[model samples]
Target: MSERKPRKDAARNRAAVLAAADELFARRTSPEDEVTMADIAAAAGVGKGTLFRAFGDRTGLIHALYEARVEPIRNAVEEGPPPLGPATPPLQRLPALLDAILCFKLDNRHLALALEGTGSDSPYQAGHYDRWHALLQAVLEQIPGLTDSDFTAHVLLAATRADLVEHLVGQRRLPPEGLRAQLASFTTKVLGSPALPGSPAEQIHS
Candidate 1:
């Protein structure tokens, strides 16, 4: 028999779908710039069945996009340097991480709103949220005179919830720079850290 043809191109199809979806959302000024699954499927040059098979549903697709955008921040937290890397002091890292988070939400505001509005449960119950919570809680556990890291992590993450970020940036018109400063200050207060010379908490907005 002649050589068998290679099976269908799953990886290529997935990349195409993600790329198309990213472009569609990147151009979105509002959540109303909604691109349906059929639209993405058409744009990616794939069938609706393939898009569903690859991503399960619209929410799943949205989550995938969120995860993709946030993956770099996650890697930095897991393996990069001071304030984000594992080696950074917990108090410093906490605020720094929050800054990263706030920026991420601001940068991806429209996408975050789309994802946040989905499902009955809090979006924090999903993928990267658990990792962020666990990492933050673990770091908080290392600090002295601090209690309830578990609860603390949940609360901190809530401070960056999509709707709130949207309100601040989209409605209240908070500048990204100003928001970063406010968050850094809030984190410093919550962590009970007096700003020391060049400390992560002190320097986060810098």
Candidate 2:
């Protein structure tokens, strides 16, 4: 008989391994107490060798998890709602993008925490920061009469980051809707633009 192909079960096993690793990493309170290859393999009902074959090692697994979770957000910023168009005013586009980005952070808090946990020294951290900075710069380039547009863009990006939002919402127990509104107002003020009329709170809650 011809050699039988690996069954669908093998594919399931690989997915389970990655999922388990991601969960463990996200929940880990400290790097020292983080999950091991054996822990992930056992959780996924696979052998250590199988896990290794799939992801090489723990660092590889972490990298995979980071990419899997972050790529979607990056794609959304690039192509999703509030479509980028030359006709769209920067004042209009800026608030919409800010809302979209804050919504993403609210939804993906755990994944963001995991990515940020890698520290500023990590390659992944640097790449993420650079990507965000570029996105902010693109948005700012459309605005008029800014003396230090680039610096202002960087500040805006930092204010909207997941970690800062989580600190505001999760720790401070501020309503996400209210927080977004406050942020949108503050952002417009900092950029020397008039606040968008009507409370973003109503739109957020609705």
Candidate 3:
């Protein structure tokens, strides 16, 4: 019973920490004010030591929280129905994937910014960025005449960057739906839906 009790307590502590962190993130508008390990420990009714033990450090905790939030979208893209699922046509799924990303950013604005940051630093090194870039590149490759699929994917994903979305929605005051439509339209033009834009693919990301 002693061993079992510790395991149960660990599970409970993890859950409490994640819940507390979510609430804190939801309330704060800026990552600078993001919940600290001490704050999270207090809110979760645990000790700071426990929070550190569970998540390593502030960045690790943010990484966990971000991954937890993105899991549903990940699952939907990997296995769910049309537009997001693997079975959908590459052309159709491409826009749908971008739309999903935009909507995710809109829905989890604070957390998204916290995870990816609002800085001008390149996020290409992040794991999520790599996953998205690879998936998008694979899809673009399947579309005939769409050369330089890799570069195209990166540029396309850039259109939905966390900071970009925040700027468009928070500062520029563009409606979320309107931003989405513009992205879809921009994407359609690039993909040669009705027809590809005259600009060459190599110059796209540059």
Candidate 4:
């Protein structure tokens, strides 16, 4: 009974922390750099020690929150319907997956940025990134005559990186729809889809 009580309390505290962190990221207007573990701890109504113990550090907390928020997309790609699910054709699913990722970053801009900011070389170091990359590589392998699925997956995922998203949407203020269109076009080109009029790929082929 004593052991169970501590476990229950730990789980409850963890949930509170995640909920608080999610709310803060959702409503924050200030720079993501300004948000801190202390802020999350205060918002969660837990002591700083509990926050650190629960998450290890700010990066870990951000990762946990990111994983929580991205869970739905993961589920959709894993078992849900066409476009995102496993049943979709690789060619079709590739773009759909990338589009979903781009939209996720756009919707959770600050949180995404914060996660990326924690990395030095690239956000690819994030643990969740490995799962995405592995899934993309497997999908790429299903494409006929496609080579270097590993490298190709890396390149494709880079297009949806959080920092790039922030630059396009946050700095340049590109409309969400416009960004989605651009990514679709880019993916089409990468997958060797027939080039549309005025596309640079079309010009090169011409």
Q: Report the error of model 4 at residue 57, Å.
A: 1.0
Write model 1 residue lDDT over 83-169, tens digit each, in one string: 688998877778788878888888888887777766456686666678778878998999999999999999888888888897887
lDDT of each: 0.81, 0.67, 0.80, 0.84
Q: Compared to the true structure, candidate 1 yields what TM-score? A: 0.87
- lDDT comparison, 1 vs 2, better candidate: 1
Q: How high is each candidate's TM-score?
A: 0.87, 0.71, 0.88, 0.88
Query: Which residue pairs collide in model 4, if any?
Result: none
In candidate 4, where is summed lDDT lowest over 10 consecutive residues?
196-205
Provide the global lDDT of candidate 3 against the true structure.
0.80
| Residues 3-52, model 4: lDDT tens digits | 99999999999999999999988886635456788898999999999988
Better of 3 and 4 by lDDT: 4
Distance (Å) between predicted and true CA of 186, model 1? 0.5
How high a TM-score does candidate 4 get?
A: 0.88
Error of 1 at 188 (Å): 0.7
Put down candidate 2 lDDT per residue, 18-104, tens digits, no spaces.
788767756654335657788888887889998788778765676677677667656655665433333446776666666756776
Residue-by-residue lDDT tens digits, candidate 3, 1-206: 77999899999999999999989888876546656788888999999899889999877887888889889889988898766788877877888888788788888777777777522355666667889899899989889888999899989999988888878887789998789778878999889886323222211212
On lDDT, the stronger of 1 and 4 is 4
